[model samples]
Structures are given as C-alpha cells and as structure tokens.
Target: MNITRRALLAGTAALPLVASAQTASGVGRRTMNHVKDHITRLVDQHRDGVAPIVSLGDPVLRQPADPFDGQVDDKLLAEFIELMQRTMRAAPGVGLAAPQIGVPVRIAVLEDPATVSDEVAEARHRYPLEFFAAINPDYRPNGHKRRGFYEGCLSMPGYTGVVNRPYSVHATYTDPTGHPHHKTFTGWQARIVQHETDHLRGTVYVDKLEPRSLSTTENYLDNWNDPIPTRAAQALRFHLD
Candidate 1:
C-alpha cells in the first residue's frame, strides 16, 4: 500500500496506521518520536499526566451526572469529542473519558473492533461494527451478571485488572450534539462501556476488584488468568474506599 504523503503527515487518522507500520518494520529515532507523539496526545493534554476536571476522591465522580443539559453547544464540545476519538484510536484503549485526560466534562468515546457473528452478520450489514460515544451517561448492570474479563485503563497506565462485569448492560447518554440516546451492550462491548463510565464517576478498574484478583502490572499482563493459584487473596482494590 502506498503511504500517501498526506497519510505520512502527522494527524489523527493517519498517525495510527503509520505508527503501526513503523513498529512492524523497525524501531528508529524518527519512528520512536512519532510513537511518542501519538501516545502523549492520547495519554493526557496536561504535561504532568493529570486530568484537570476530576481529581482523586472527588465527590462529583461518585454522583451520577445529568446528561448534557442543552447548554453546552456542539461547536464548543468539538475539541473534547476529537480528543476522545484520538485517545481511543491511538492506543490499545477500547474506550476513553474526558476526566482521564483532565477535561471535567461528562464526555467519552468507545470503539468495539470485534467482528460480528453469523447470526448478527445480516444485522451488521445494516449496522456494522462502528464506534460510539456517550456523554453524561448512566448505566445499570444486573448485579454482577457477566463473565470476568481482563481489563486495562488509561488513568492507571501500565496496570490492568481481571475484574468481574455484567455480561450485558443498558445505558443512556447524550451524543456530542446534545441528542439523548440509549442502547444495550453485551460481551466485550459491555465491559468497555462499564469501564469508561466508571471514569466519569471518578472510579477506576481497581475499585471493581475482588481482592484475590488484583495484581501488579507485571503479574496482571503477564501471568494473567494463569496467575499463581492464590484463592485467599482479595481479588481487587479500590483506589478510594
């Protein structure tokens, strides 16, 4: 495939593909610099890697927030929307939130790259595997009614967790344009939505742990589900309580 000069230029859409190519080829100074730029932009706008809107132990993170109350305009929210997309696309992230990037607004985006099944393929022909976003959202899970999956978060960076989540969920939120919307999610998609939503409420994956499931970066990403059999330990830890 031709790497068009346009594609080579640094920006959102092309940067991801180019970075992937560079890594597959070989690591060099220039390629490394491009990777850094892509990762930095995705991590946070702040130089110090802290978000401005929600801080640790903020009450706002706990209380459910109202949908964008029709006051914030589309033009004004455009940057946050763009940041959300850049955040999710440039990294291994399946979803992202404004607070994690230091923007306090109730905004986030998600992408489910999984393939559709044969049963859903016909439906997908009409509605393919696409990206979605939720603004100032609320969700309900039927009492930990889903399978446990490995999860990672941008805020926690490098560290990941194996947490239990509802296999399915339903949520309501506004689009970037202030339009109210609702949808149901299941499987990996359900997990991503719940993970990012927690960010809006000032919580992290660490909070969803069961004590015995918690592990350091090395342990979680490496040993993973094959973790040394230690059933007596707490599965997870909550950063706050």
Candidate 2:
C-alpha cells in the first residue's frame, strides 16, 4: 500500500530492493552513465553518504529495477552495497532493496540478529541471518507449505499487515564478487528472500497482504501484538491459509 503524504513527511517510511552483476549486451553505455550520475547525485545529498530511502509514491519504486549489468565499476558497486547496508541498519530494518534508495537495480542486502523474546521467535520461526547482498536474485517455492505473519515495509511505513508466504524456497543469486550461488531458505529467512526479490519485480508486501488485517503500527503494537496472527485473523475475519 502507498504511504500517505503525512507519513512520508514524517519520515517514517521503511527500507529498499536488490540486483545481480554480469556482462550483458543490451544495456547501453548511455543508460549506465545516467544511472551512475543519478547515484552520485543521491549520495551527494547526504553527508554520511547514505542515500535517502525512497517512499511508496516514488516512480522508481513502482518500476522494475534493472539487472546489475556492470552499471557501475566494482568500487562504486561496493560503496553502494555498503550504503544500502548502512541505510537498512539506520532504518533499523532487517533488509533493504536498491529501489528503496531510488536506484532501480536488482540489488538488496539483508541481515537480522533475530533479537526477540523466545515466544515471538518460536512462533515466527525467526532466526539470525548474517548480512549478505543478493544481486539479480530469484526464488521458487519449495513446496505447497505457507505461513502467515505480520509484515511491514520501510517504503510503506506506519502500517503492518498479515502476509502469507511460502514456508521455504530455493533461491539463486549472484554475489557482489560476480559468483553465482544457490541455496534453500526456510522459515523467516525464506520470507525475507522472497520479499526482497519481489522488489526487483516491482512488487511489495501490500500486494500480497490480507487487506483487512492492515493496522497502523500503534494499533498493531497495542491490539494485535500476539506472537502469531491468530487473534488478528479472528478479529479481522481473514483466513490465513
């Protein structure tokens, strides 16, 4: 869902999307140059070099991000990844995608210390994930299993909704060093991977969320803070499966 102007002005919107680096023939030099220039201008605006996270209404967030086809040199790409990681941590979010930073590229960084109460952790199947970048990442559901939980976005700020996602997924992505990797992620980590990958495709959690389950952050904390979303599902009259 789109954030209201009031929320955007309040600077409450959440984190950004990711992409891969590989040589490709279709990407024009001119386009890459423009992207480089755009990134430079964005980074220049902040003293700490952290690009401001783009909000929901931004066109960049709605458009599909380009694949990281040598858009910038290795040094610049590294700096951008580091900037994204810093932005995610500053946003205090578990993940961030490139589109959130106004860069329409298939790139994202994710990490979660999973510092929560035991009950919450167990209910959500939450666990710590080491920081890693996913470029041009894609995933496929491993089975029919799915799980629903409260989800929020940095771009959509101030709201949370119940989203059912595949319980596990087999994912493929290229790392910053241009090496390809494949792995299966389960539980909360699978959810994080799918969420970021969807950004590269111009999708957001709201698109897949239970609309009736939507709640302002305050309401969510006050009324529906259960480890599982059973109470919310019952009260909201929404099916979770």
Candidate 3:
C-alpha cells in the first residue's frame, strides 16, 4: 500500500526562559530530569541515530506523556527533535509523537507534502503542510462537522481502520523556540494534528475506530483505497457523520 506515503506524512530550537518556571518545583524538576536522562539513554543506545519506534502493547504508548518543561537542555532537546524527525520520516508517517519513540513527553512533529493523486487530494482535502514541531500541543474541535477515512499509525503498523475526526480544529501549542502559537487547521491537516496530539494523551486511533472497519494494510490497499471512507463505512455497517 506504500502506506508511509499514503498514511504517514509525518523541528527544534534554543534554550528558552520558560523552562525554569515550568519545571521549578522539586518534583517537577526531578521528573523532567528523569525524562531527560531516559531520552539521552535512548539516543545513546541507537548509535544509528534513528530510534526504533515502540509499538502497540508497549506501556509507554498508553501512558500520558509529561509536559515538556526544561526536561532537557536546549541542545539535547534539539538533538532529540532531530532524532524524532529522522525516525518519523523513516517510519514514512505523516506525524509522530514522543511516546512513539519511548520518550513520554508532550511533543510531536508533522508534515505532509500532499503528494497524492488529484482525485485523492480533492476528496480528502489534503494539502501540503510544511514540516514543524508542536510542543505541548492540543486542539479543540471547531464544529460538529466530521470526516472519516482509513487511518494508520507508525506505532500500529500493518493495520488501518476507519476513524472519524473533526474536519476543523483550533490548535494551540509552543514552538521549538519557546514561543506559543494559536491557529486553525482544517481538512487533512486537522486530522494529522488530532492524531499526533491524541498520542500525548495516551490515545490511539483504534480506540475510536469502527471495529468492523479494521483491515490489514494489504486488504486496505486492495479493497478500500478510496479517498473517502463512505464505501468502507457502508460495507462495515458503520455510520459516519
């Protein structure tokens, strides 16, 4: 199915002044330090630079990630961000979360060049999004409007299911530079944002997917590769809003 290109499309910066305040308490400090050390060890263990992705059944994927405070110094955070970007690209996914790589921090990177057939692009409302990092990111649905499509994840390889998500969202997050951003995302970009942010909350698409819609990647490619999920929803006897 060339899933990486079809499914996954899925940043860094300096030491900012905010880390000190966010991690000021002794307990918070300790937690951040532990997370930092763990990340360091993971990086060191993967001499090849791309850390192996943790998959389903791994406890790390189910635990809510700690908020990114000054857990690691700016340099280390930059290195980690680069490492994440490398791993995500290697996974051939459009987005990746920290926990996916065994770092349980509220961070994720996402980008989609929107390189799909014109029919798919139009049907999916897919467009190109420049690569960027989202630290401590979150989102709210813009309205009741929703769309469903076959979704896949790097952490849950070889499977896809129909998951309906808000068509638009109001997203907020900090950039790698420590600056905060508030923006609106629509279409496929909104889906990508929600997917990655959900990871920080210890949620996966499967939790919300239509169970009957689950299919192996090969089957998805062979029988349900439509740009939209209408056919899958009907065949699977699931309702889509």
Candidate 4:
C-alpha cells in the first residue's frame, strides 16, 4: 500500500533506533556471513522479478525456531531478508518464514495484499501489499469471536481448506535484527498469521479443517470464487448412523 509520504515519514521516525556491534564466534560468524550472502542474492533476484520457492522437504521448513539471541549482523540479517522475499514472491504470497525454507531460524515475513489507503483511489491501485517481519513469533486469537473461510498453503500446494479463525489477532515477535515488535490484525491478515504459525508447529491447513470442508484441488479452484456457504447449511448436514 502506498503509505502517503506523511505516513511513511511518521512511521520511520517512530521506529526505535538501536545499532549494535557484530559479535565474533568462528562458527557463528561463518553462518551469519552465509545467511547475509543469501539475502543479497535474493534482493537482487527480487529486483529482477524472479520469484523464489521453498518446498515442504526443507529442514528449516519442518522445525520451530528458538527465540532470537540478538547477535545478528548485516550478513545474517541479509540471509533472512532474501528467504522472506523469495518465498513470498515464488508463492505469489504475502508471508513466509525460515522454517518454511529448510532453515531452523526463528524468522518470517508477511504483508497484506490489500493495503490501499482511502486517499488512493481503489480503481487506480486497489491492492497494495505491505511487507512485515516476525522473528520467534507468537500469535493467538484476541477473543472468542471467529470467522470461517478458505485458506491455502505454499507447502501444501494444490490443497485448500475451509477453517475457522478469529476475526482479529494480537501477535508478538522479533525482527531480523532482534528488535521486538507487536501488532494487531484483522480479516485476511489475521488469517495468514494464524495459518503460517501453524506451519511453525508442523501442522498443515488440512489438519485444522473439518472433513466436509476438505475439497480436491480441482474442486477447490472451481469453488474458490464462490461465497462461503451459509452457517446453517454447515450445521444441518446428516450422516449415516
């Protein structure tokens, strides 16, 4: 989303500014440098418009990450930046994490695909995406209220599921640089966060869906554009006794 110049300036000015020296541990330094190089490559790739993809078999994609230790330098930070950009770009997605790419690091990036502001005419740019980073994240529903909708996953590929999610959420996490951040989200943003966090826990979207909600990929695509069926229909189904 085009944050008006005023909004962008205000947001930047509000950020906490803290710079720390990079620490030296032989193995850690090597790892950090490697990650940094990856980030550089990914950024260049993004500029060239080639999307990156992280598959389901990667080690990083399978494990949950530990909390950040705050010793990352430019190099380590760069690796994470590249992973985030590549995964999101390749999936034509708005969010992804290190665990999704075979790295066990506690990191993820997300952006809302619909970020247009009122001042910008929707007809001119109806869908504006904004990127966000989350390291060692924790997310949960803010209340008992929920909404049911269809969700898709990059690792799961052609699969989609109908699942219930909270209408809003409050999440906390560190940034690639080990800085703490918090935010609240609603609608699709909340759904994406909840979905990705499940991946961090080694769960897929299918695990969270009811049997009736499961659909073959072809059927899913066909019905994906249809409005959600009414709640009454969901409640009225009968099965063989």
* Winning candidate number (TM-score): 3
User: Tens digit of lDDT per residue, candidate 1, span 1-241?
Assistant: 0011121122100011244565577643344454244334544453333223233455545543323433234554565466567645554355677665544446678775544355442322212236777877778984556565445555444344456677778888777765778788776666677887877676777788655555555555345433222322333433211
Candidate 3 residue runs with Cα over 4 Å from true position: 1-26
| lDDT digits (tens) for residues 82-196 of candidate 3 | 8888877766778889898888899899888777899998998999989999999999999899998878888887788888889999999998889999999999899999999
TM-score of 4: 0.66
Q: Give candidate 3's TM-score.
A: 0.89
Q: What is the lDDT of residue 239 in candidate 4?
A: 20
Global lDDT scores for all candidate models: 0.52, 0.79, 0.81, 0.55
Name the top lDDT candidate: 3
- After the best TM-score superposition of candidate 3, give how far the Cα of residue 232 lies from its true spot, in angstroms: 1.6
Candidate rank order under TM-score: 3, 2, 4, 1
TM-score of 2: 0.87
lDDT of 4: 0.55
Ranking by lDDT: 3, 2, 4, 1
Q: Give the Å error, residue 180, model 4.
A: 1.9
CA displacement after TM-score superposition, residue 167 of candidate 4 (Å): 1.5
Report residue 114 deviation for candidate 2 (angstroms): 0.6
Clashes of each: 14, 16, 7, 8
Which stretch of 10 consecutive residues in model 2 shows the poorest summed lDDT?
Answer: 14-23
